[model samples]
Target chain A: MRIRRNLAGWMVIALVLVTMPALSAQSGKVTILGTWGGHELAAFEKVLEPFEAATGIDVQFTGTRDLPAVLTTRVAAGNPPDMAALPNPGQMLELAAGGHLVDLSQILDMDQLREDFAPVWLEMGSYDGKLVAIVLSADLKSLVWYNPKEFAARGYQVPTTWDELLALTEQIARDGHTAWSIGLESGAASGWPGTDWIEDIMLRTAGPEVYDQWVNHDIPWTHPAVRRAFEIFGEIARNPRYVYGGTTAVLSTNFGDAVNPLFTDPPRAFLHRQASFITSFITENNPGVVAGEDYDFFPLPAIDPQWGVPALGAADLIGVFRDTPETRALIRYLVTPGAQAIWVSELGKLSANRRVTPNAYPDELTRKMAQTLVEAEVFRFDGSDLMPPAVGSGAFWEGVLMYVGGEDLDTVLEFIEAAADDAYTSGAATD
Target chain B: MEREGASPLVHLVIILTCLVWILPTLGLLVSSVRPAHDVAATGWWTVLRNPFDLTQYTLQNYREVLGAAGMGRAFVNSLIITIPATLLTIGIAAFAAFAFAWFQFPGRDALFLVVVGLLVVPLQMTLIPILRLYSRLGLAGTFVGIWLAHVGYGLPFAIYLLRNFFGSLPADLFESAFIDGASPLTAFFRLALPLSVPALASLGIFQFLWVWNDLLVGLIYLGGSPSVAPLTVRLSTLVGSYGQSWHLLTAAAFVSMAVPMAVFFALQRYFVRGILAGAVKG
Candidate 1:
């Protein structure tokens, strides 16, 4: 009788402990952290609504730009949110390295992803060839946006090659308009626009093999190919008529504000080269100008046709934290075509899945943008973003400024190469 | 006649200085009231050009900031931390300064020297060891944790200033108080504190500002949860890779400033009096 009572008490205690998790975790709410503004948040809410209504999961969205800080602190405190939307690939890797992220391999199908993305983007979100982050959308940087009305009035044709581009720039100058409106100044990360210009030109001038070697740190920064790219950039940037504010414009003008003058009456600039995301800022500020009719884009002209202008883009990564059954469902939901359809329809975003047809783009420019994204044969994530912030937001941007501010190309390249080496090496040290 | 000629120039200089100082603040205030889209499209000063277009203005930014999770909680937390901190610091520093200035003891000058010397050590150098000590004491992430840390950090400057004012006190009054059989504590309360009001007021304002605007120490020791964080920590979250959300930022900044401004206005008379008293007494 005594033994049986003791056994019964132990069984009761074990059952209570086992059932406690079920009781505490009864509420099926999944929390997500993301940026506060734009169509992105609006879209996310729309996508999650159906899921929430179906499963009775209450979605608590924490809108914040500092997702990394919140995610890091919460994970350390052992109360991480279910999912987090990260803009930078490097941060996803950092979280993975710290043993904080859940292994998403079994949950996500990596083989079905678009093969056009730069290999580094693939590696940035992968640990030991196991996928950790699901890439949702991309922002392409190798397109030259221009006022179609102005181009038509001027009887201008889109340049097909580098020689034509330079000739066309001179022609546009003769036609009494700025050929390029380059603004790179973004404080702390001030020189990224210039870096994008360089990367775009390099893709047009230098082939993917050489680009890959440079990205992987195999090619020397002072290589002839690199020097040639800077010199070409300098020629256009330094030419007073080619850019609105000339070389100095790249330093003082805010990158977002650079496109403002281009939309002025008589068109301050005939050509403005920037990523697709800039369309929103442009169209928002300029009320009447239609995107597809008033303005159009052509891929940055090939310096040499063999190189093929590679698209410079960035991806938003969603990494899983806790591998509960619900978390797996969320991850699987995110990587699916249906999930992407909801994002595209609601968010006005470029989808990572080529199969999802984007219907709810904000404007004709974004419609063209959607088509361009789907048709892209090669896409590379922002190289600087792949680097640590100290380098990505620091020395890399500074090097671009130094070059624009009249530092010799060879010297800036050498410094950047050494800086990159030191940064990655030190990054290893911290880990 | 000589003073008359100088008055115009002095007024001109003062006006120019005020204009220069106030323009940016005015712009920030104006920007805070304008719609986010409008702010992005034009300069903040454009509103003054068309002040009657009230349709362009919006309280959406402030509404968003206030509605954010834990903002009210943070405001309450800041008050809880700052009020007691200011009072405790003034109370303790005033007492210590009175003793240091009036009493004669072994190492009297040397002890004063040591207290003053602490002012020179950089606060950053001591943060790590103190943080480690805090962890050992199980004080991290609690209100009491940050309060104690702030008290420790704020003491040297507080003690130094009060001691200077206390030292400047009229010794004859203290002697007279003693002769009347007033205890040291009674003499301090009756004679020292009353005369030292100017110093106390200035110190209170200075400490309040420091404790209010502080970010690093607060972030490190208190942890960056919305539940416990001050406005500075919340403001930092507005900055991310794309760029600062300037609309939200301006509103948040002004919201944080409202308290300090109110505190300053409420205490300005006392602050001015404190300075005047210090000058006269010294």
Candidate 2:
């Protein structure tokens, strides 16, 4: 009965096709599976038009946040998409570990990438000494976004050092305005923004080399540098005027949703120190404001020169499956200087291709950001992404909340250190 | 011997309990209608300050979400997957339940026990194998594939429910039919099945809601084909790699709830009867 129905369905399909135009000279399609949706959905679709026109290969895109999980299911079932773009390096590693990825070593031109994309990104996508993914846009996290008019009105200047950054917060607090708007509540993953704060602090206080050691577990979680990062973070979190609703509000507000009040009239708070992505949220809340006049970002200032905190960047890696001659051509087209140019001009995105000029960014601040990213001597990936997720996502977030709620620095550190040990012991790290 | 009126304390306690139970739902309702900025910055009660701020209460969210990412198609796909899964589960379970309750066969108890044993298998453990099977059969990423998967997973509890209702049917009725030389199928259709309406209706509503609200199975098997995805998948897509659009998310949440609420209310009269049927053996 099923076969008979299928036959009848085919006949219907044939009838429909007869009325429509027949296939052209080249019709083989490639499905680019990804999780970009909402505003980004429009951006990706716009970019795809030019690609399809150039290649004559039909490009079918399916967007969902659960794209990785869905792709896992599909690949396990032997019905994988032609290509998939996963945000985390760990996911690419997992796919390669499962032998689900097609090695791109022979095709992709790695030499053409940005000279300074924090080699850690390239390393993250490599497994068994083979490249599986290409780092796309990079996000520089060591930047603090602020209202330029508010700061100037308060006689505040952009802090050049960590001491100045701290002093400036106190100065802002003395003026009776809230110093920060720190919101980390992102349901089920409630404490990630707090984690980002800790990461920024670590990059500023501990230096990148120690940061790298902590990621590799060569330095224990209880190391002095790790402890100090928490101390500095807690100082701000505990100070009543530093954050509105302080500890409680930090726990209450959704991180993405938290940026809104800062952009409101009379401004709920003065500053938010998040990555470049927060611009989208700020843009959403304040409609007619331009970046340079209304808002801008300063590089996260250094506590001392030894801290190595000029910049920190994170990247989303794009990987391949079943690489063939056709797929090779596709990758070459995707990462070439020309393609990066299109991504910037059309999509308003930062491209990982170093050969492409940063001047292509539509906004002045983004172009400045691209220049700063290129000049940075040291860069680090998001520490949480490098750690085993069980500890990184679960324990780390929980630990940050505990610290914010006034748990002692040592106790919080010990709890996370033990959780990390359990994570490693359970074989979660090795895989 | 009756008191002239109930004690004020008792009345107050009942009102308080009702409020406590309804608090989260009320919060969600209020939060759903609120401006995304206000919801983010302050509590939902802020709306009470200037309740008539028509400017703040725009349907722009609803308009945007409905227009977002092929959600209209997802609604149709959800209905397509849910209706058949519900019907097929009820049909198969009814037949199986009738056999379990009325038929006599060697090892019938053991067979029923085996079916009950299946209830212990975690659905997650079986997901990979079942997915592989669907792909092998060319059923992966199809509407029929999801329906069959839902029905297969839904059957054990469904059979258990219907069998209890069938068992309570008066034994005299089946014997009377047997004496009249009516075949089992004819007796089932004419009498037993007709008497089992409440049970079937309740099961249908339950299975429909589960399949409709489901995200994991739909996502894994249906392939996010906008033409085939359900509300849950579409709602999740409103959130992107960077952040969420709460305006759209709130609207999407309300849209997904509308159909299920309608299904519940439409069947509510039968719902009460169905729930109480097996409790009274007559």
TM-score of each: 0.79, 0.90
Name the regions of candidate 1 deviating beyond 4 angstroms.
A1-85, A98-100, A106-122, A287-296, A320-347, A354-357, A360-364, A388-390, A424-431, B1-10, B33-153, B172-192, B214-241, B273-281
Residue pairs in clash, model 2 = none
Off by over 4 Å in 2: A1-27, A67-79, A109-124, A324-329, A341-348, A425-431, B1-35
Please write out the lDDT profile of model 2 over residues B47-108, one tens digit for every residue: 77887876666677777778775777778768777877887798789889999999999998
Q: What lDDT is reached at residue A144 by model 1?
A: 86
lDDT of 1 by residue, B148-249 (tens): 777777888888888878887878888888899999988877688877777888889888988888876676566554556666766655543355345677
DockQ of each: 0.08, 0.35
Tens digits of lDDT, candidate 1, A1-431: 55347657755654553343335445765656665443455567678877877777666555555455555655555555677778778778887888878877676665665353345555657886677787766667778888777777778888888788899999988977679888888765589888787777676678766766666556666778777878888888877788887777767888777777766776777777888767656655566667678767887876776766667777778888777777777777777667777776654457666566546555566667767756656667776676666667677788888998888877898788777777665432221
Q: Write the per-residue lDDT of candidate 2 for residues A1-431, one digit (tens) a residue.
A: 45347657755654453233222213666666787777766666666667778777665566766665678778887877778877667667778989988777667655654363346556767899887887766777877888888777768898888789888888878888777888878777788888887888888777787787777677777889888888888888778788877789888877886677667778878778787777777776566678888889888887768765557667757778866655666666767666666666544556667677766687788888887777777777788876777777888999998889889888998888888887763332222
What is the alpha-carbon interface RMSD for each candidate? Answer: 9.8, 4.7
